[model samples]
Target: MKNWLLHILVNAIAIIIVSFVFSSVEIEGFIGALIAALILSILNAIVRPILVILTLPITVLTLGLFLLVVNAITLAMTDALLGSTFEIAGFGMTIIAALVISLLNLVLNSFIKD
Candidate 1:
């Protein structure tokens, strides 16, 4: 339970960091970041797996590079669901933001233990 909350906070921080990197990825504030992060986490867990399986052939063909597209899809889904709170400008921006957020999350999560 504690770990879960910490994970969410880490994701929120990652979102905030990513927002700073790209002007197109606009997070209203910390609360917006938290909301976006939570939605992103939910989508990543529920939607990302299905996408990974569906795109497994291409994923293998690309040597896992396609997972970045999967991540971007999930990020776009989160933006759609959040309405105005979190806004990613376009598909190109989504892909870039997803990449940065994924990298940030990877680095942040490494510090936390299960």
Candidate 2:
């Protein structure tokens, strides 16, 4: 539970950074960002694996590059579900935003001992 909360916090930071770095992505406020982050985490943990399995052939053909598109779609899905709380404007921005969020989450999670 603590680890999950920590992950959520890290994701919130990532969302803020992504929103600032890319005009296409936006979080209305800290609360919205937090909610979006939590939603993103849930989606990644649950839905993403199913998606990867369903798209295994394409993923292999693209040498895993298609995962980026999958990430973008997830981000867009988060935005759609959360209404204006999260917004990813375009495919290009989605790629950049997803990469940034992933890197940030990895770095932040590393600092967590548990």
Candidate 3:
């Protein structure tokens, strides 16, 4: 339970960092970031696995580069679900933000365990 809250907080921080780095990724405020983080985490868990599995052939063909696209799609899905609060402008920016968010979450989570 503690770990889960930490994960959400880390995600919110990652979202803020990504928003600062990328002009296209706009997080409205702290609450918006929280909502976006939760939505993104849920989408990643529920949708990313299915996408990874369904695109296994292409993922293999691309030597795993396609996973980045999968990640971007999840971020985009979060944006779509959240409406104007979390606006991820384009696919390019979405992809960039997703990559940065993933890295931030990984590094932050590593040191932020329960």
In model 3, the runs with Cα more than 4 Å from the true position are: none
Per-prediction TM-score? 0.95, 0.93, 0.95
Question: How well is each residue in 36-95 modelled by candidate 3, as lDDT tens digits?
Answer: 998888898899999999999999999999999999999999999999999988899899
Residue range 1-114, candidate 2, lDDT tens digits: 988898899899989987888777888999999999889989999888998999999999999999988988788789889987788887788888888898988898889897
Q: How close is candidate 3 to the true structure, as a TM-score?
A: 0.95
- Candidate 1 least-lDDT 10 residues: 36-45
Candidate 2 backbone clash number: 0
lDDT of 1 by residue, 1-114 (tens): 788789999999999998888889988999999998889889987989999999999999999999999999999999999999999999989999999988898999999877
lDDT of 3 at 10: 92
Lowest-sum lDDT 10-residue window in model 2? 84-93
Highest-lDDT candidate: 1
Q: In model 3, which range of ten residues has the least summed lDDT?
A: 105-114
Alpha carbon lDDT of each predicted model:
0.92, 0.88, 0.91
Better of 2 and 3 by lDDT: 3
Regions more than 4 Å wrong, model 1: none
